[model samples]
Target: MNDSPGWASPGPAPSDGRPPENSGGSGPAGGAPESTPSGAKWSKEQPPAGQWSAPGTSGQRSHAQTPRPQGWNGAPQGGGWGAPGPGGWGGPPPAAKPGVIPLRPLGLGDILDGSVSTARAHWRTVLGVTVVVAVLVQIADIVLQRFVLPAPMEITADPESNPTEALRQSLESMQDSMISLVPSLLISTVGTLFTTALLTIVVSRSVLGRSVSLGDAWREAKPRLPHLLGLTLLLSVGAMAILTVAALPGLLLGSVGGALLSAFGVLAASVLVIWLWVRFSLASPALMLERQSIGQSLRRSAKLVQGSWWRVFGIQLVTALLTFLVSMIIVMLFSTIALFTDGSGMGELLTGNSPEFGWAFLVISSIGAVIAACITYPISAGVSVLLYIDQRIRREALDLDLARAAGLPGYGTEQPADHTPGS
Candidate 1:
């Protein structure tokens, strides 16, 4: 191999199992003759070999000999031909880094750092999309909580005096909780869908060291929104179905034994749901970047995750935990402040009453929610996109394609065309 970075070429392989002709051998003469094909050739008009000093030596060359031209035979001045330069002979070239990450298989740190770097580099676009989606979603949630959803049922039941009435009140409270939860869940899901789609584009461009705008991301992501929504709904329904099936038998039996069995079933079902969720976690990026059908994207994700399930799951879990912690901190701080500012909320807490939050409390808490969403959305989306890219780099040698796409030289001869994301 040549001793140059990014320009090394493989030597010719022997046609048969034997070594090539003229290669050095343990012969009486110590090797092949000077005329052999593999032997180094010397110029006819060469200076005396001993006259020039060896590279890196302090000894001076004979002044009688003529000075060689600067950068003779591609070597820097004062260096022997083919001598080692700053990088020693045959060292691997540094990976190309056009954007947030180097085009290579990524480690956990690389994945996390890349996500943050992408968001930081493209804060205008990244924050813009996330903030808008977060604000809209929070507004909808606040409106639903304050006006559309029913008020919290008063739990005035005294089980000692009226057991039946207490049971009925408990059921009503559960019903109200579900009613409130469903709308919030739906709103959050919609918000995630849009942010995921838009931020995926931003992250993709950032990987290629390119800047993108909110308009550009929307234009690129608009076509894939419906498919993404379908994917989200499909995953949600599948999980719900699993849980329902697990608990149905217990509910129908209405006995202690059946309830025990149902609990076990639900536990097992939860494990299965988690496994499947991680297995298909990369589907969103695959769908958006590859422009693939929902089925194909799921399959692609499964294939990428097949052997590295634990690694992918661990990375995703860590990301989720970090985001959750950050959001919790922000929400808790604001909620605490809100409690002090809203007299009714403070009174309800003090009296151990169900808090009927007023508009002041709701608006303050919503602001916290908006801020949390803005921070978490970009991070979550960035990690997902980067995980997908990391998996592809490991499995498909995607770094080469990424390097080419970034217009890095020495990767390929042909120029990259305008292809789909990840193509």
Candidate 2:
């Protein structure tokens, strides 16, 4: 199977044994002609900060340092400093710093940087995809909240009524709230699937050090939509079933074992659900990138996640926390400003006790939701794809393949059988 689906294709072998340029890809800056002075060789290694090195000279480094490259700012440049060819001045490859990520076995920092870099490097494509999805989802949510759902009913504690009646009323109210949330949940679910599919392709292309347009990403993702949707549904059903089974002990034994059994069951289910979620999180990337069936992708995720569960979990946790933090900051800022400007009862709105739904409130909150989604989606999707790539690198020596795919010259040999973690 090809390592990169939709992006990597085999062709006539290069005459000089150099790795062929990426199929359907332009050089670093979206297909610009990349060249260097002929006869000069560039190093395969990146020099330390503030230092440059002449190629083919071990331990011979230059003291001269150029300012950080332009692409570092996340701006799209036509071409960056190109590597010198044979007998030309040896320098960094033109695609060396294409986008945000370097093609290699990634560290945590690399994953994080790659995530942010992708958004910055291809802001137009990445943001465009996310903004359109988010705005549509938000519009759907706003419509559901403002028009379809019945107006919120104020429920007060009925001290004069029987306790049993009051409990029943509270339960009914809770059920109503849950029912009203269903449309929003469905909207979010669909939005996540579409965005993840598209962005996964974008992130994958970035890993290959190639730039892709929104159209390219959508075209690559479209055929996989059904598979991606099925995979998501499978996971969702599986999680719900596991939790239900876990809760069965509590439900059946409720009176016999009291609340202790219920508490234990809930706790155990939560732990198992989290573990499984983290473990299978890479399944989506595998399904989309490897073009595997649902079963194959789940098994592939398990295989890759087997020994690296904690590492993957930790990285995912950090990404979630970071995403949440940024989102929280953005939402809070917007909400605070809106609360002051609109003067719609902040207390009631925040506490979810408002008896009335204000159009202004819905619009403001939806705007925040849209902004947060736009920022968080790429980071979340980028981390997953990068994690999948990292695992392949660790277990399958995928870095060599990625290097060659990115058109790095020296790594064109077949991946070694004796793959070491640090290799």
Candidate 3:
């Protein structure tokens, strides 16, 4: 069974993973990249004020010998002359010191930066396939709308015409029709495969520098399907069970009692459901890519997310808001134009009855998908993969892998050599 569903068909993939460690090299402005080791720079042992060297001169002088790097003017290239300002009166901006890890926090900007870098590296795979997949799926939608739905409508409308009843009946028929088809089941099964593997492969290849083909993603995903399916069924049953518990009053008592309690039950169930969702959101990556079993992966996800729940939730919330607002704005703009512009009308036009339905909505959505994938897929993958990396860093001291990948300068098996930007 080919695991390559619509997502990974010989195209660009979004990048994701832990950021590689920097070699402690400085850029022109003296800023170190995120990948640099925290202990990058070297600081010297301080001497007494009386033994301080004069600015631009090497000999030990007086109690306030050097005027500091700033006031001294044109201090030489080597690392000797700088000092505390007058009477140790605070320094000259601390001589442009390098940053320390104690000062590091996982800011929104850092995750967003990781996301952006991931995309830059793997966007081609993402774009090439999303457009094609979306087009094919939507064309199937179009064909269904154009040819298939009309006959059922005609049969129900002709004055034997219980028009409203016929419409309702047709809808019921369609609903029954949808759930039982073999092809649909196959599509759904394949879709599951796509969701689990393609994204991970793209991400791993992009961030971890692994070379993965569509074939590779599929084969890797195959053995995991049973486990994934079990997880899915488990979640579905769990959700229904919770909802059923919530609806117990309605189920056994009078309608009034059930109605009164239903809302609260739903609220409680929803909270639990959301908690579970976040807890397991990264589990697919763990199971599919990391080769962990269902129970183990869930535990791993929870552990990785232990201190970062709010941050992860916030990141997802932002992604949702952006996806919703942007997709809506574009769709509505096309819809408004269709409503007002000559020949751009929809509705009856969709039944081939006033004007054009502005098919660009399809294309616009496709573009939105690509942009969304570019922005989000990588972030999602990167965060999960980076969490994996962070675990390794903590356990195996794998910051060395990150440094090597990033091509950082001056890192080794032994202690890292301290560096000063100029020195």
Which one is best on TM-score? 1
Report the C-alpha lDDT of model 1 over 202-260, residue by residue, as the tens digit: 99889878889999889889998999999999999999999989989986775556667
lDDT of 2 at 317: 96
The residue-by-residue lDDT of candidate 2 on 196-309, one tens digit each, is 999999998887667889998888999999999998888888887987677677666435353357568778888999999988999999888877789878877887798789
Give the higher-lDDT candidate: 1 or 2: 1
Count of residue pairs whose backbone atoms collide, per candidate: 0, 9, 12
Q: Mark the regions of model 3 whose C-alpha exceeds 4 Å error after superposition.
A: 1-106, 136-196, 208-233, 251-257, 334-380, 387-398, 404-423
lDDT of each: 0.74, 0.71, 0.47
TM for candidate 2 is: 0.71
Model number with the top lDDT: 1
Instruction: List model 3 lDDT by residue over 62-151, tens digit each.
Output: 222322222112232234333445764332222211111101123455545544555565556544434444445445555554455443
- Higher-scoring candidate on TM-score, 1 or 3: 1
Error (Å) of candidate 3 at residue 297 is 1.0
Clashes of 2: 9
